[model samples]
Target: MIRDATAFLNRSLAVISGIEVSGLALVFGVLAIFFVLLWLRASGRARLAQRALQTAEADAARLDTVLKVQAEMSGRMQTMAEIIGSRQADLTRALSDRLDGLTTRVGQSILSTTRETKASLSVLAERLAVIDRAQGEIRSLTGEVVKLKDVLANKQTRGAFGEARMQAIIADALPSSVYAFQATLSNGRRPDCLIRMPNGAPGLVVDAKFPLESFTALQQAADGETQAAAATRLRRDMDVHIKAIAEKYLIPGETQDTAFLFVPSETVFAALHEDFDDVVQKAYRLGVVIVSPSLLNLSIQVVQAVLKDARLRASAGRIQAEVRLFGEDLERLDARVTALKGHFAQASRDVDQISVSSDKLQRRGERIAGIEIGEEAGPSEGLKSVAGE
Candidate 1:
C-alpha cells in the first residue's frame, strides 16, 4: 500500500507538472501573440494587426488599435480645425479692412455732398439778391432817362459836351499834333477841331454831329413800315448832317485834303454799318470819312507823319526860347563862379602866410626861454662847470 501510494503520488505529481507546463506554454503563447500585436501597432502596421487578431482575450491589443486610430483622427481633425480657424481669422481680417475702407469712402462722400449743397444754396441766394437790387435800379434808371433827354436837347449843353469829348479824343490819339478846339480856319468858320499837320498845314477837320434822334428811332421802330420810314428819315438826316460838316469845316482847296466826321456813339456806327453801308461808301467817295473814336485813334496814326513835323516846329520855337534864357543865366553864373575861385585862392595864400609867421614865433619863444634859463644859472659859470666836467 505504501509503494502504490508512492507511485500514484509520483504520477499525480507528474500530471500536475505537465498541466503547469501546458498552462505556462499557453500563457507564453498568449504573451508572444500580444507582443507581436504591440509591435505591429508600434510599427504602424494596423492592417497586419487586423489580419492577425480577432474577438479573443486580446482586448488591450484591440483597445490599443482603437486608441491609436482615435488619436490619429483627433490629430487630423485638429489640423483641419486649425486650417478652418486660420481661414476664418483671415476672412475676418479682410472683411474688417474692407468695411473700414467703405466707411471712410462713405464719410468723404457725405462731406463732399454737404459742401456742394451749401455752396449751391449760397450761390442761389446771392443771385436772387442781385436780381432784387437790379430790379430796383432799373426802375430808377427809367426816371433818370426822361430828365437826361431834356438836358441833352439844350444847345449849349450838348455843344459843350461834344466839344469837350472831341478834345479829349483828339488829345488821346495824337500826341505830336498841335490840337486846338474851335479853331478859326482860313474860311473864318471856326471848325470844331483843327490839327496842325506836317509842313505847318491843316491836316483834317473833325466835326462831332451825333444823329441821336434818328439812331434812337431806328433802334425803337416796331414794324417794317415804321422801321423803313425811320431808316429813310435817319439817312436823309445823316446826309444833311454830313453836308453841313463838309460846308462848315471842310475847305477843299484851303483847309484840308480829307475831312473827318467824328461820330462818338458806337451805336450810330453799328447802325451805319447795318442799314446804311451805302451811305458809308458815298461819304468815302466824297472825301468825307466817318470815324468812331476807336477808329479815329488809328486814323490819327496814319497822319502822324504830318503832325510830327508840326510838333517839331513848335518844339523848336520852345527850345529856342529856353536856350536864350539859359544862355543869359549861364553868363551870370560864370561870373559868380570865377569870383568865388579867386576868393578861395586869396584865402589859401593868407593861410600859408599865417602858418609861416606862427612857425617863426615858436622859434623866437624857444630862444627867449633858453636865454632866461642861462641868466638864472649864471651863464659863464655854467659854461665853466660844463667844461670842467
Candidate 2:
C-alpha cells in the first residue's frame, strides 16, 4: 500500500507542474496524510514484538522449576527403597529361627511318647504270663480231687484208710518199746493197738474199727422219716461196738480198767458229739472213751512225760551216794593242811636260834682283832670271854 501511494503522489506532481500554482496546495496535503499513516503502522508492529519476548521468558522459568522438583523426588524414592530392603531381610531371619524351635519341640514330644508306649507293652506281657501259670495250677488240683473221690467210694478201702492213719499217728507219737500194733491179749483176742503203762500197771487198748455203714446212711438221708430211721440204727451200732470193746479188751489182770475208741475222721467225731449225745454217754459209762486223732496225740504226749519222770526218779539213789563220798574226801584234805602249818612254825623258830649264835661269834672275832700283837690277850682267851657273855 505504501508503494502504491508513492506512485500515485508522483503522478499528481507531474500533473500539477503542467496546471498551475492553485493545485500545488492540494498535492502537499495528500502527501502529508500518507506519511502520518505510515508512522502509526510501524509503532503497532514494535509493540507486538515486545509482548512475545515477555511470554517466552515466562515459559522458560516454569520449565526450570519443574526439572528441580523431579530431581528431589528421585532422591527420596531411592532412600525408601533401601529401607524396605533392610526390613525384608530382618523378617526372613526371624521366621527361620521360629521354624527351628518348633522342629526341636516336635522331635522331643515324639521320643517321649514312644518310650511310654514301650513300657505299657512290657507290663501287659508279664500279666499274660502270670494268668497262664494260674490256669495250669487249677488243672493239676482238679486231678487230685478226682483220685480222692475214688478212694472213699469203696467200703474195704475206706476201713483200711482209717486203720493206716491211726497207725501212722501212733508210730510218730510213742517210742518203739512202749506200744505194739495188733497185739494179742490173754483172752485170745487181738486189739488194734496196746500201750504199756509205767510202774508195772496193766496195758491200755485202742480199737479203730467203727460202724461206718450206719453213719454213712445217716449222712445220705434226705427226708425226715429216713433220717430218723438212720439215726436209730447208728445209735444201736454204737452200743454194740462199745460193749464188744469192753468185754474183749478189758481183762482184769492183763489190761487197764479203761479203753479208747479211736475215730479216724474229725468230721465224724464232731457230728457224733453234736447229734448223738446218748451214744457218747453210754460208751463212757461202760469204761470206754471216744477219742479223735488230736485227742489221741495229746494223751500220748502225757504218757511220754510220765515215763521220762519215772526214769529220772530211778537214778536218784546213785546220785546221793556220790555226794556223800565227795564230803568225806573234803574233810581229809582239811586235816592234812592243819598239820603242815604246825611244821612250818617249828622250822622258823630253829632258824632264829641259829642266827643269834652266829652274831656272838662275829663279836668275839672283832674283839680279838682289836688286841695288838705286842700287848693283846691270846685268841683262845678272847674266844672264851665271848662265849661266856
Candidate 3:
C-alpha cells in the first residue's frame, strides 16, 4: 500500500505540475497577446502622432510664412498712410494759399465798387437838384407865357405890344441920345422911332404900325379859298401900310430914303417873304422896308456899329492931337534934362577947384606957422600949384 500511495502521490504531483504548467503557459500566452495588442495600438498611435506632428510642422511653416507676409504688408500700409498724410498736408496748404489770394482780390474789388457807387450817387444827386431848379423855372416861364398870350389877344394891346417891343429893341440897341421915340417929322407925321445917323444928317425913320388882323386871319384860315382871300386882304393891307409909311416917313433931307415898316411878329415877316413876293417888291419900290423885330434889331445894331466907328474916328483925331502935345512935352523934358546935366557938371568943377584951394590954403597956413614969426609965405607959388592941380 505504501508503495502504491507514494506512486499515486507522485502521479498527482505530476498532474498538478502539468496543470500548473499549462496555466502558467496560458497566462504567459494571454500576457503575450495583450502585449502584442498593446504594441499594435501603440504603433498605431505612434503613426497617428507622427502624421499629426508632420501636419503641425507644415501648418507652423505656413503660419510663419503668412506672419512674415503680414509684417511686410503692415510696413507697406504704414508707408502708404504716411505718404497719403504728406500729400494731404501739401494739398491743404496749397488750397489755403489759393483761397487767401481769391479773398484778397474779392475784397479789393468790393472796395473799388463801393467808391464808384458813391461817386455815381453824388453826381446823380447833383443832377436831380439841377433838374428840380429847371422844373421850377419852367413853371414860372409857363405862367408868364400865359399872361403874355392874354395881353396879345386884343388889337389895341397887340399894337401897344408891338410898339413897346420896338421901343425896347431900340433902347437896348442904341444909346438914349442916339435914338428918339415918337418924334414928329418935318411932314407933321409922328414916326414910332428914329435912329440918329453918325454923319449928323437926317435919321432913319421906323413905323411900328403893322396889319396884324389880316396876318392873323391868314394864319387862322384852314381852307384854300379862305386862305386865298385872307392872303389877298393881307397883301392889300400891307400895300396900304407901305404906301402910308412911304408917304409919311420917307423925307428927302430930314429922314432916310428908305422907311422901315416894322412887323413885330417874325411869323408875319416870314409869311410875307414866303407868299407875298409881289408885296415885298412893291414895298421895295415904294422905299418901304418891311422889317421884322429881328431885322430891326439887326439894323439898330448896324447903326450902333457905324456910330461906334465914327466915334472911334473922332477919338483917333483927338488922340493924334494929344500925341503931338506929348511929343512936345518930351522935347521940353529932354532940353531941361540936358541943361540940368550942364549945371551939375559946372557945380562939380567948382567943388573940385574949392578942394584944391583948401588944400593949398592948409599947406600955406602950416608953412606960415612953421616960419617962427617972420614967415614969408609965397602966395604966387601956392596959387600956381592950385591952378596946376
- Number of backbone-clashing residue pairs for each candidate, in the order shown: 1, 0, 0
lDDT digits (tens) for residues 1-389 of candidate 1: 98875554444232443463344455566899999999878777666566456544377787888899999999999999999999999999999999999999999999999999999999999999999999988988888677567756675665565566677877877764367777787768887787766664655788876666677777789999999999899889878877777777777656786688777667678768877998888788766888887787787777776566656887998999999999999999999999999999999999999999898778666654555463667877655554443
**What tens-digit string does per-residue lDDT give for candidate 3 at 1-389?**
98875554444232443463344455566899999999999999999999999999999999999999999999999999999999989998988998898899889889999989999999999999999999999999999789779877778888888899999999987789998998888778889998889877779998888878788888899999999999999888888889888888888998989988889889889988998999999999999888998899888888888998999998998999999999999999999999999999999999999999898889777765554433364666555544454
Write candidate 2's Cα lDDT for 144-189 as tens digits: 5686577667777667767777888889988889899899998789
Runs in model 2 lying further than 4 Å from the true structure: 1-148, 322-389
Higher-scoring candidate on lDDT, 1 or 2:
2
Give model 1 RMSD, 1 decimal.
23.3
What TM-score fits each model? 0.42, 0.48, 0.52
C-alpha lDDT score of every prediction, in listed order: 0.76, 0.82, 0.86
Of the two candidates 2 and 3, the one with more favorable TM-score, higher being better, is 3
Residue 65, candidate 2: how far off, in angstroms? 89
Among residues 3 or more apart in sequence or in different chains, the pairs in candidate 2 whose N, CA or C atoms overlap within 3 Å are none
Clash count (model 2, backbone only) = 0
